[model samples]
Target: MNESNGHFRPDKWRIYFIYLIAAVLFAVAGGRLFYLSVVKKDFLQNQGEIRAVRTVSIPATRGMILDRNGEPLAVSTPTWTIIANPRKLWELEQDPNAKTTPQTEMDRLAKVTGLGRSWLQEKFEVNRNKAFMYLRRQIPPQDADEIMAANVVGVSKRKEYKRFYPSGEVTSHVVGFTNIDDAGQEGLELAYQSSLQGTPGKRSYLKDLKGNEILRIGQDVSEHPGENIELSIDLRLQYLAYRELKAAVTQNRAASASAVILDVKTGEILAMVNQPSYNPNDRSNIEYDQLRNRAVIDLFEPGSTMKPFTISAALRSGQYTTESIIDTHPGYLRFGRQTIRDLGNYGKIDLETVLVKSSNVATSKITLSLPQDTVWNLDYELGIGSPVGIGFPGESTGVLPSRPKWHPAEIATLSYGYGLSVSALQLAQAYMVLANDGYKVPVTLLKQELPLDGRQVLPPRVAKSVVKMLESVVERGSGKRARIPGYRVAGKTGTVHRVGSKGYEYDQYNAIFAGIAPASDPRLAMVVIVNDPKGRKYYGGEVAAPVFSRVMEGALTTLNITPDLPEGLREVRLEPKVPYRLAQGG
Candidate 1:
């Protein structure tokens, strides 16, 4: 009886100890639950939410570039980009029994998307460890749809924007092109890239266990669309000028060519063209030389076309008059060690006759007698040796040697356009000074609202006399080929030897013509340049003047300018000249 009683007492003590331990554990668990649910509840909830939410960037649409007449020059079109979940692709690769390998997937993608298999393979290999990767960007909607329908594992399609140039090569130099990422690359695109590129916005949302967007946990942010740009280019005129310039380059077998048409009164760039142009849509076949926009980028000695400036400057300085005579007998003048000669010998002649005959000797004598300040100051005012502020990416500030840098012969050479350089655009703008009542208006490419005030660069009487002389050039001088039957055209011809690595190449000449139509009341100022024409008649009158005539005629007609030619006059013919071989250094 004593032994059984002792055993029961021990068992009861053990039961009491077990109950005490259980009570302590229950209180500790209650305290922990209170701390987590009440004290740190907001922090714990935020941590869980962050793990489930993701923010994504939404790209905005790029701006459109339009011509002055509301024609589309450059625009953006909706496209698609192919993305991949690299982790999912890796998982498939790890499965030995999987039907496809990463290489096979890439090959399939390349076949459907017209991309190289090697390129896709490299991209896939680089992002094998990443969860998301871009397989291709700027894909057309049709191609994107095909890829989507194929049900390729780990692949997704996102909408994007791609640039579209409807005018193609015709407007390439003016409107420019954009890159694959929808960023502006050249021309106006490069000039206004910041204003044309839109701002991207962010979007955050919650996804469920299956990765489906369930609820909108964040506000929808709005994106800022890019501002549209209106240019001063006229699409119809631009096309006409491009076609005519291209025909001239091909017919003359020229190494290159360029043209620019400006509104005399408004200083608006109506059309600009360059030969050996590239199709922005198919950049794969583009050559570096063909990509050059020669109208604004190239500078060359203007030859006889620059004669008017010297004569104008002399007239403005009261040093010479339209009837002032210069003795040009012997057709040449010796200055220091250099002797300058004219294209042909002329005796004593007035300014008008000098211009009509384009006598280099006469011009050299006149410019040399003038003050150095007159020459330098006149060039600066006419926009030479300076930017035109046309808002282009690669405009050249043509070289006009400073006064101190001028040699005795330099002034003579510059008088007839051999020692200095000027762009086709600058030439056109300078001519506009004579066309617009002796005022030099600032050139612009944008569609401005108000008319720009003109700065007087020459006297009205002097400008009128210069215009008459220019008319005589077209009517009876070397620029006769530039005449249009139904219009009164005034211009000058320039045939200058091209400077090479060693010296001037004799047969490699730049044939150019700068002109304004309806001399009585000029409207369009056009400058045409044909470089290194391989033809027997490599003169500006033979190679470039005819092109100017045709382009100007067409452009003026398209713009509905009234005809101002004298009755009974007929359009000049453009007969192809015999091809000439390029000579060595002149």
Candidate 2:
């Protein structure tokens, strides 16, 4: 030790060494801070985001399907989807430190979500290794909220929608149904799926360990809701038609039935219905065949209904008129080996009587006398063998065979509506031509503000003549049962033998009735088809005509259509005269 300024001092080298060590330590710490802040910033941020950040989906609302009068047919209801991180759920359940026991927790979940406990447990075990799984989809929002309040670990609720049918089975075939994910499955729903479906949005959110949202970041994409659609169907008329058709089907014990009514002026379908329908809200008990829209899909021979077109063709040819005479002697006509016959000997009948009695032989003779393409060409111009073009799914263009050479049997059968097939919709459309005074209006299921210009498929005079002749059919002919009280109804009856695997099945038949109302000023066109009715009554007049009458009656009243029949001609409900004793008691 050396004494300086009367005090003992340590070595200078020791002080210098301590200062150098401190400087070195500060340099290392500064370099590490710079590297972390500049070189590895994005990697660390991404890792943290993976743990606490999530991309959440924002559900958009689906559009509503409304009837012509603004009545709701199909709608979307707010709902939630229950999902789970299965691995995390299993871990929490197995943890001895959990707040609730596994059995009790699962039981609570089952009760709240309406799921069986055993089923949930099995699903959990099956997906134990999956990071995500659906527990229950399209559950009611209230139930989902209740589940969320239970604080089940690794459980989450997502926004979703469930489709609801307001009219239930009444509009089932028209409005159709959606899947659990709010996607349209059939009918108009499937036809307009692209417009009916909405675009989902996305956003980033920060969630807590318990799967609860802590904060929501900015939205990455905007949600686009579906467009609302208005259909041409009138709910009032639809209900009436559905009720009458169902009653007819049940009473006749038919295999199936369909009915369609149109606004003649606008070519708008006012009501369409099919029997053997299913409830859109519940599909668990539904059959595949019940989902079909028979009015637009099923095809069958149009029977005597095609006679009006043939008669119109004849009138257009200037060779025949309403006063023209047709020889149907012996009630039958022979074409080679095939024979066309009538129910009775309607011999030497006039043009009107051919339709009045629905004489097949008379129609065959008239069709044979005319040019080869007369009837077929008229039928083609009347929208036969063509689609209605309403964008309906599975719409059929009923078979209209085009042959280079016509056989005598084919010509004979074609004259009586046997060689070609037509849907109820197509038949109705053809009748629309007669009702619209020779103009062929475009058919649609969408509401129209004004009447559209129609194509002139037939001459106005010929159409009017045919329509006038058709009035005699309901006045005294085969479609007598289709008469509506106080209304001058013009219609035709058709009874077709169903074709089986071999040929025509004699025991089975398709009973059809197509008609127009208020003959003085046509406003409505309707077609009814009852397939394979059992028992003594299977004719179009007895089966399908009655349904047309009942439905047309209610529809006329509902639409406030003016009655054309005179007061004296209108049917009166007679009441028996009260006796003197009964009058005294009253």
Candidate 3:
């Protein structure tokens, strides 16, 4: 070693160079330490939290769908969804020597969840790369408990809900059901989905080394439960309608049928039911055909049920009266190439008699005499060719002539309930106007404590006149069979030809009866429609009117209304009352 001066000293440049290198290294290390402990401290903590934190849902129960009397029509039951960590399942599959191989674990799941083994395996294989997967949806809680007891690795259960329709196929078309995720698919459920669905809550917490997710869970937010829906439907009436309609359908071998009941005072739908209903609870083999709420969604030519409205239009013009005489003697009238005929001529009868007879010739004479716009305006006022606004899903606004222009033949056809279409709901609403003394009440599925404000349609006198004519119909006219024993029922029969691609299919008819009961003081209006009955008798009076009679009888008796007919004249019915029940828990 060379001395700096006289002695052997360490090399000065080498010493300086080593000191410089050491200082640079110290600065670099210090800067890195500062960056880690100060600048990036929050970032690192968040990373750690992200690894340990868990998210959880605070499930909210869906709302109950209750009838007007608070009977549960649709209810949500506690259930569980089978979930799994596919990544973990795949990891288990890769290990041939593992005690719980993926197949073994899946077999246990399949057994508990009632899923096929092949399905489980195929699903798992397809989702091998996925971190999460839904194995099954809406299993009974007990089933989930049994599955959880098995402790299949990577598999778990999450709390959820399932919709159960206690009324089953009876109220299936009205109350409807929900999907696996609990979304409404049809009927009132679909119509009031936003209000019926509840908000899901959230929770977050940190995980410990034991992997105990339950212990680590902490609430971050609370869930809001859904609001209960009180529908205008009367469960008793619904059952009655459903039972009778089903009976008629089976007896007559009809394609389908629909029945609706309305409160005359408030315009609330008392009951609505349809045939060809699907079970919402068991949708394994659901066909789209069985899902329609035919009462609200199906449109048909209303035929003679529309005659009362035509009478209203005529009387509204002040040019006609109930006693005004019309000659239907020839029993037919020629308009262009079309001939409007009566079932049989009633000689020369009053205008009211025309409706009672459902005479195509007489009603046409009266309608053709009226101003064209006046007839169309009457239809518009009656909620025809429009939504009744009962808030049903896929509700039909039935087809009407796009323009005001009506050919002479078209006007004649319109007079006799042709060249225009209407839904059963529209028919019901129009009858409500007659029942409410010419007040066109807004039809609603929701219950109202008092009758809501409605536009005055016809004069009270005209409305009473029409009702009188309808009473005549039930008394001795085509709708005679619809008469209730203790009640003076007023209604009309409609047997319209079903229109097809080529033209009207005369052989295929929609039999319908529209009536308001207790003619002494109106309370209920009902409509019954039987589609394409293949029986020997296809008249509305024969098919649809009978259903109306039974339903009105039951409803009247159930509501305990006093007999409006003379004491000795009240007819006796022997039908047993059906009980309403709640959804059964498994």
Candidate 4:
């Protein structure tokens, strides 16, 4: 009886201990539940939501670029990108009867996406283990639809933006182009990229078991559209300038060419063109040489075209007058080890004659007589060797050596426009100073709200004198080819040898002409540059001047600018032969 009772007692104690442990566990569990519901409820809810939701980015539309006439220069068009889920593709590959071979899969993708089979194969093979992959971008809508319709488990299509240039290479230099990601990469596109790139927004929604969006759980953030840019370029003038310049390039068999037209009153760039151009739509096959915008990017010595500025400076400083005379004899002047020579020998001439003849010796003598400080100051005021103030990418500040760096020979060389470098735009701007009656307007690619209020870089009288001299150039000097039949054109011709890596290439030259039309009251300023013409005639007068005449004539006529001369007045013919005279003593 005692043994049985002891065993029963042990069992009873075990049961009691078990009950106490159960009660303690239950209390602990209740406390844990309360803590979770009160203290960590928000954290637990967030963790649960994180596992079920996915976020995505939506790209915004880029802005359109329009010309001064409201013509589209650059625009965005809808496109599609193809994405593949590798896991789905892998599942298909595992099926014995499924299209498993990379070749077959790539062929199918290429057929639907319009990409090459080998290219698609390489992309597909890049990471076979990746769950998602971009098969192609920039696919046309029709092609994208076809690919999506194939219902390949992993493949999907998303809308994207692609850039389109309606004018193609005709306005490439000014309108510029964007990259694959629809971001501006050059020209005006890049200059105002931030303003032209729109903001992207986000949307969040709840998806059901089948992945169909069912309920909106959160508010969507709206996107901000990019602002459109209106440029100062006149599309008609741009087309005219491009056609004329391209014709000149082809006719002369030149290496390249460029032209720019600007409004004299507003400094608005009406048209800008560069030949040997590339279609932004097909940049993949473009040669680097063909893509250069020579008007702003390339620099060359201005040759005789720079004579006007030097003469104007001398006139403004009271160092000379229109009637000021210098003795130039033997047609040659020796400075240091170099001897500068004129086209021919002349005894003596006045400032007007010096400019009319574009005499190297005479101009050198004049520049040398001026104080070095005056020359340097004049150059700076004229915007030489300085930024053009036009917001263009890859613009060059043409080299204008400091006065202290000048060698005696350089003074003579610079006088005739050989030792100094200036971009085509710079030359045009300098000529504009004379056209605008001494005011130096900042060059711009944007349309002005009002007529430009320019800085006075030269006295009005001095500028007038230079204009008269430039008029003489078109009338009786080397720029005679630049004259229009009904217009009083004023301009200068430049022909300079191209500097090569080894040295100056004697046969290679850049032919240039900068001018303004209806000289009685200037309206438009233009510059034309033809590089390395292999034709029989390579001179600026022969090659570039005619282009200037054609383009300027068309531009003026298109803009309805009346001729300065009366209806009955006959076109002025170039003087048969102006008496050659040297103004500086050698």
Candidate 5:
């Protein structure tokens, strides 16, 4: 309180010092503000945006799979995936102001999700420190809405898809199923995955302090929904084939079975089914073995079903005709240590009679006389030992022995379908050649606008002659059971001893039948294979041919094909039509 002036006055130096301090402070603040607002503006703004902006994925819907008739085979249903931020949920439970605990909300969630309370508790405990966890996957939309309406803190639901197989196990092997992520896993679903799958889009948005979306920044990419697939399969024929094959399998007590039907002219698969099929929709107790598409994936000896091909090859050689006779004396022939035998001594018989009797001895003689590679070339042209070209997964090209030099015994065995192997699909395709007048059309699963162009493999006259000869087999030979009323049926039967770890199992056999319907003007070709029948009737004619008869009758009628056989000549079908619901899917 020192007074320098005459009156009481503050110190002049102290006032000047206070003003200088004020100027310096203001200058520093102004400089810092200028630096932040102008010089460092872009960098600071980017950092701020980084903290506030969030990117989210916009899910795309998966495509549907339909039959040729527009019936749904595989479909994607809108579902939800429940997710939770465990840390946030735990924090909410600890907050005193919170109205409900995580446990209570979780209990509510469990009831709606069909999950046990103990499971939810375990999940909560296991992921308590984690920021995110899946609560339940692929729950119904209604259930998800109920859970979201509860507003259980960090718990939220995400839109997703669940694959549903409308035809269930009937069409499981063909249409296949998708994983929880909506990605295909098997069958046509896996084959056309890229085309059927959709591209997901991205969206950016501004989030608030509480992690709520404050503003949408617009999508960077537009979502592209998956493309729909329409298969060549006819659901009615698929159902018919599946029912008949399953019934035969159960009746024969077979280990497994497969059947395939095709449009002879178009080479389009109309129906394909396998026994012991697993439901694509429910896989809780699924067996991996049952998931195989045996029709296209499994290989077996085609047996006498190859006889027609041998005859066709022989006829094409110009050395033989339908009337060419082969002698099968004593019913057996010795090729070194291996002896090829027929059911009985068929004496001297014409080529048509050889097929009717299915005489192995006669076939071996015919094959031996033909030029080398004649049968092999014909088999190759017929798609034997080749992929069916339907783009199915794990399709076996089958085993066609290609050696620099072939043994006479090897040729004989191949003539009887022992050394070579082929899939049910390949067998069906080969028969399609005969049905389509020797033209080799490319087989497919996709629907066609018009019949695709086909390459000629055999002379049309030869094909027609074989088709006519096959009719006699169904009429009086081992394939009598395959005879269908009001239709001139043409088919061949095959019975092969299943090869095991050591050699062919004498007791176990594969029964097979392949044929065409309305033989006068063939339209449909089919093949049925039953493996390891435990019943007494294991022969192709006894077991597989019966299934062929029923399915062919139904398919012919369904297609509205004209009955070629006169009413007087058409015998009354002794077997009653099996009762079934057309709603079943294959």
Candidate 6:
């Protein structure tokens, strides 16, 4: 009977059972807490971010291209892109189930955005299934501000940059331009892309469901501005050269023309321009033909412009002097049943006259005397058949025929610039060597500090001697038309027939003039080439020399280069339309 309370014994173990139940419940919760805090943390955090936070690309500004004088050639201006999260905006307008339909909302978007309702609707329809779309890119900031003020849901604004060329087509071939994405497409813009394009940055921030920022998360990464590049271009000289080249090209009815000016002492490219230049800002209409930097990319036989190098090579051999005479009783030289002709018989001319008159015969005689290796080596040293190392993209190496042996005919043609080709820049570099007292400096489009110590390509005495002869060519020979008042110009005229599919096209020619200004102590070297003139005349002296003179005159004046000639000297004006037959471009 005392055991009658057997069921009553439950109270004795009830506290332990309660403790056991509590312990099991606690253990289950701890496991769940661990899973939530550790194993599933990343996935949950990502899901939260997907619903609330947004990441966007930050655009970095491209650098400004400046002239050495601190003039802006290419610059980046702030622009805005109108963007929309179509799905978000659609949902925002639809959640209330309001009277406004998606089309009505889009029309309102177009009206506020200044875009036609049709365009807006079409744009929205194309991407209605998607979340993001660009409404319009590169609109003015004022327009973007107007759109922002319209309180259009899901329509957002982003900042970007657009490249502008202050000089436009005038510097198109040198300063170049960028594409719609702000990447360099041509000229120096492409060459210095890495140095000019800055790194973009990012930021993370807390935002509301409406996509409004509540607070910034962590430190905002700052965007680094692109480095400013000061180029060697002198805008004044660039424009002057461009105008004259354009005029000559138009007047001559030429297919194209190119010109380059260099600071001979520094080996800096002061100006480089080409005809048919396109506006870098207008990329959509640009033709493939107008995209090349012709001065550095296009190659043509330099004709008589190549003669000076031949003379320099010969003089270096110690076997010839500027006064060394080469007999030419006949007007041409015959080698292996091939004849090399002069404009006429430049009979018994000295080496100086060989260059002064650009006598193919005399040059051939001198060239054949030097070892083929000597000639090629000299040419290579001057940068012929090689890139001028200006960092221009697609720069031509030209065509230098390599052989252990050369036929007398090959030597003859090469001496006078046929059977070889060179870019206009290469021609300028070669002339710079002659102008810089036989030192060949690495040419550059960047401002150089005293120029890399030049390689001695020719004896200084020999280079000076050739410069003197070039002075003669400008003062009295074929380059007379290139003479600028108060500046003793030294230059050679070249009119070489363009080699065609069949051979030389007799009527088509490349008229060229390569020159050094203030010949007494040369400070500038320039080259001008007019290709395939359709006008009545096409001679280097007539077409190219005058362009050189006009450009050089402006350059000398703009740079305030002291006049070497007497103050009273006046420029000799030559008629533009005259039939001036001077030394043929080789």
TM-score of 3: 0.88
C-alpha lDDT of all candidate models, in order:
0.84, 0.85, 0.83, 0.81, 0.87, 0.84
Winner of 5 and 6 under lDDT: 5
Give the per-residue lDDT digits (tens) of candidate 3, residues 1-586: 4554556455777799899999999999999999988999999878887778777787888899999999999998888888987778768656778777787888888887788999989898899887688987888877778888988888888888888888898888888888888898888888889999999899887765433464555447888989999989899999898999999999999999999999988999999999888888899999999999999998898887877888889999999877799988888888666666766657899977787667888877787888877777888888888888877778899876756577777777777677788888888988988998988888888879987888898899999988988888877676767877767889998887777899978688788999998887888899999999999777787889889999999999998878788552466333321221100000
Best by lDDT: 5
TM-score of 6: 0.91
Q: Cα deviation in Å at residue 441, candidate 5?
A: 0.5
* Model 4 agreement with the true structure over 293-351: per-residue lDDT tens digits: 78899888888788888888789889798888878898888866677777778679988
Which candidate has the highest TM-score of all? 6
Query: What 10-residue stretch in candidate 4 is worst by lDDT?
Result: 577-586
Where model 6 places Cα greater than 4 Å from the true spot, the runs are 1-36, 39-44, 92-94, 97-99, 209-212, 571-586
- Residue 426 displacement in candidate 3 (angstroms): 0.7
lDDT of 2 by residue, 279-395 (tens): 999899899999999999999998888888888988998889878998888977676666666776767889888887777777778878888888899888888898989899999
lDDT of prediction 2: 0.85
What CA RMSD would you report for each candidate? 6.0, 9.2, 7.0, 4.5, 7.0, 3.6
After superposition, which runs of candidate 1 have C-alpha atoms over 4 Å from their true positions?
1-51, 92-125, 208-212, 566-568, 571-586
| Local lDDT at 415 for model 3 | 72
Select the stronger candidate by lDDT from 4 and 5.
Answer: 5
Residue-level lDDT of model 5, residues 288-307, one tens digit each, is 99999999999998988998
Quote each prediction's TM-score: 0.86, 0.87, 0.88, 0.88, 0.88, 0.91
Predicted candidate 1 versus true structure: per-residue lDDT over 349-466, tens digit per residue:
9998888888878877888898866766887899989988887888899998886656758787778787789999999999988899798888998876775987898888989899
Look at candidate 5 and tell me the lDDT of residue 221. Answer: 82
Candidate 4 positional error at 286, Å: 0.6
Question: In model 1, what lDDT does residue 269 have?
Answer: 90
